[model samples]
Target: MAYENLNFKKAHMTFDEGYFYMFDDGWDTLLQRLADGGTAFSYPLSDTIDSAVTSLEYDGINFWTLQDPGAGTITIRRWQVENSICWLKNTLNFSTFDSDTFTVEHYHTSLAATASGGTTDIQSASYGTVITSGTVLTLGPNSSSQYEDVTVSSISGTNMVLVSGTQNAYDSGDEINFYNNLWIFNNDGSGSLHKINARTGANITTYSDSEYDNITACTFARVSNVTSSTVDALIYSKATNLKYLNVNTMSLYDTMTMDNLKVNNTTIIVIYDIAIAGNTIYRLQKEAKYYGGDYSWTYYNYVLSTVRRFIDTVSISAYPTILPNNAVNVSEITTIVNDQYGDGVVNKPVSFTDTDSVGFITINPAYTDLFFGTGEAISYYKAGIVVATVTITATATQYD
Candidate 1:
């Protein structure tokens, strides 16, 4: 079974045996766990977490969460796993290739037209179909002429395609070459290999792979013999149907083609946040059971997938990590006007606690009741005159 704290600023969560430790970083609460007197490793949320932390979960080593950077509704992030693979993806195309062969001679600066298909203002557009083959082209357009404007009847290698079109004539001297945007680019470098961070929960290097321009949620899956590095560089994701990336080389593979990403049951995977622990991937799969009239969606968090049967295994128990908070530290020192002299305090206000409600100050990554990160929490504070700096006493105690 898995558990979570519903508190908005649930900044930290770690594991100690069977218990889960949690704390409110916004309010600086003490570390509280699932069980008492247990020692668990602390996974501190980073200072970069956004304000609108919608949800959170842990996968033993690191935390996975959905954040609203106020930019997009969903910004998926993983914490503590600092090692990220940054690569210059060579996925954009700038050239082309043919199956087994290509021919500059195959293209003719000329074509033969004939008045066979039609013969009026509608014009019988028939090109030389017994000498040229511009129909087997791929991507943008067919080279042989299987288009609405130019349709090929029969063509191959040196055989011309008997195409009929809206041309006034069809005999010879017409432009016949494959002009496709795909021919202007290179093959999708999706097969290219990449690197990975060796440490679990290590941040992935920020490299732009615009090819993955989508609402993609990703996580690492440490698999054996998957790469050449001591660091397992496989990234399992729902960023498009890609199964995993041997990030050690930035190379991607199909889950079906490679048989890597397999669904154990018929649970359709609608990926949310993904986290990994103990070589298992904990996915958040949402399910909506249809009873009679309406369907209410239920979330299944911590859906485990082991390394051995990572593709086939269904649910299993794992832990959650603390998601890093991406909040900006607004620690600038400033003085406010009251009656001059020495307006309250200055010099980078580290701790802004409003003892008196005189005037209010504001900050952001707007704090909400639904946030989950420890990043910059929005707070409102007020001040007044003659506020002398009062010393306070405090003591820390070990929890049992």
Candidate 2:
């Protein structure tokens, strides 16, 4: 027969001789029989022997054993021999270790509860201070907790400077350049243009104002240069004629008369309020022969078709001069000339002759000067049309 339920601690301490039985616990049969007094000799039970023999003992009303101590303040160990046995024992006393020097273990489950895609709850059961609403926790320099409040300092620059909680100072020379969205000098008298940053008043760059001919009344209409280092500024003057300024040398480069600027047999008028739109220039002019009175306003759109058309033609021949050697191949020269004029001139043949070892080419070119016809009329108009043409001869210089 099998014993269904047995408590080893409450089993009989005395037993019959010449009989053997197995204790449910792991004690040796001989030790069990000796404890029961089944042997002839009497065996005295020591504290160490009894402690080792009994797996569970009464500590007050609870069944527990005095566990062996570990290195730390609180340690636990669990072991079982057979069946449905489970045991948990604390190996150390909380009152034995020093309170000030004892180490504590912390376990955290969720850290990013406020982050995006976070689902776990942020619990503050282990922390001393609970984090309520609007309280931000920050890490300190040495990994501790800290809180901070930020503030901005002062700002300073060339044209203007600002101090915290103080008045801002503005220099007399500071002015805004509306076209370029930058600050320039109002009247520096130094004949130099200084570009300044608007926000910080810092000096960004400086350019020579001599390109505008030391004339502050002139306005820049456009800038054109095949080569960026050498640019031509198209400037308009209120009192004088239109001038092209050389940016590199800062000098008056070229000039064109108002009469020379013509389109579709109409004398172009200078209008002030018009602005340059892309490759085209639009202007508003007063028509002298308008059906209405002279006070009538008329707007005219002058599309720079010739300017855009001749740009490729001019760039081809002009690009070579800006190059290193001042020389370009025959194909490039042909492309340059063809760009200026259409393909009609490409098929036309030319005759060339060499005289005095100088290369010259001649073509049938003729024109009539209607302004001065013969010696009879100092100022004359040709066939009721004010037009002029002349015969021209040209030569080309070859480079070695």
Candidate 3:
């Protein structure tokens, strides 16, 4: 399928080992098998709905679609998969702002419980205090074996009061999942970020920052050595650069400049999207020159850098191989930090030191910049009749 004509709007990788590509040339969603070039199925939006499909998400079990019928109205539908067939399970309606893109993130919580359709209460062996009021949950295996999102309005003992009745009858020991937030960012460079409760469909908060302007795409990843704990950092591409934001702190964490970023000798024009699965990061970038007529798409996959660091340095002085005796000479040292894969690691700090304790050694810009992962160190020699030897070393910390 050609991705031209803005057909490839979103891609979702399910637990089934492949990806479901959503195309919006009037919207046609299809799942492609990665092991072989074959189609699992294709669902056309025009066949069932007249509205435009804005986003499609697979939450490890079933599928969900977000549609916009215009005028600040949005519709969300859940599709149940059973016996290799797809069934329309539920349709949820809401009134709010309009957006072209919607990102659904599953909160890190799971519980098993039993409940019936048309009921407002669900019972588990014991919920304890793990779930509270305003918390969003998803009940699995409805009457049609589908999943549905519900909000906990109140909690008492081991029971939960859902904001609304359950759509599908869930059995004992049925898996219940939780949802965190639904993100909708302005694609028009407004820097506005709107968050909605993914389970309750309620607007959580809205905020803005100039750093978030012109966002092209974003993904959640808990990259080691870059971010702390189990919290996933929101990696968003603004123009050609990628910025990392801590979701917990809602603050900037790090930035990756992609102006000269390349994969296999091809320079990336822009980053279209980013996705992370386990320790691997998948980035979709434009390989074609911007507005230059020739165009192509490229994919870059790499293991997250918890790799050991290797430093290579070269020192150059005014003299060819030896410094003049009884004269002052300056040497410029360049240090390049690379991981085990030989790829230059950017935005890393390097420390330079020399054995000279007589105060004639100095290093400038002791840290690497966004453009280059290199540092400079300058050393001076005092006028002396005796010959001496000094050893210089460059050090970069390795992250586990």
Q: Which candidate is the best by lDDT?
A: 3
Which segments of model 2 are wrong by more than 4 Å? 1-195, 198-241, 244-270, 284-363, 366-400
Model 1 TM-score, 2 decimals? 0.29
* Tens digit per residue, CA lDDT, model 1, 97-216: 111100011112334333333532121123233223334211111244422234445554433444544333444333443311110101124321112222222223434453443322
Models 1 onward score TM values of: 0.29, 0.22, 0.56
TM-score-wise, the better of 1 and 3 is 3
Q: After superposition, how far is residue 239 of candidate 2 from its true place, in Å?
A: 5.2
Error of 1 at 290 (Å): 14
Candidate no. 2 TM-score: 0.22
lDDT of 3 by residue, 8-39 (tens): 33432322344534433344444443323244
Per-residue alpha-carbon lDDT of model 2 for 21-57, expressed as tens digits?
1222323222222322243332222112121211122
Candidate number achieving the greatest TM-score relative to the actual structure: 3
Off by over 4 Å in 3: 1-16, 23-29, 35-55, 62-80, 83-100, 109-131, 134-176, 221-223, 258-268, 285-400
Best first by lDDT, ranked = 3, 1, 2
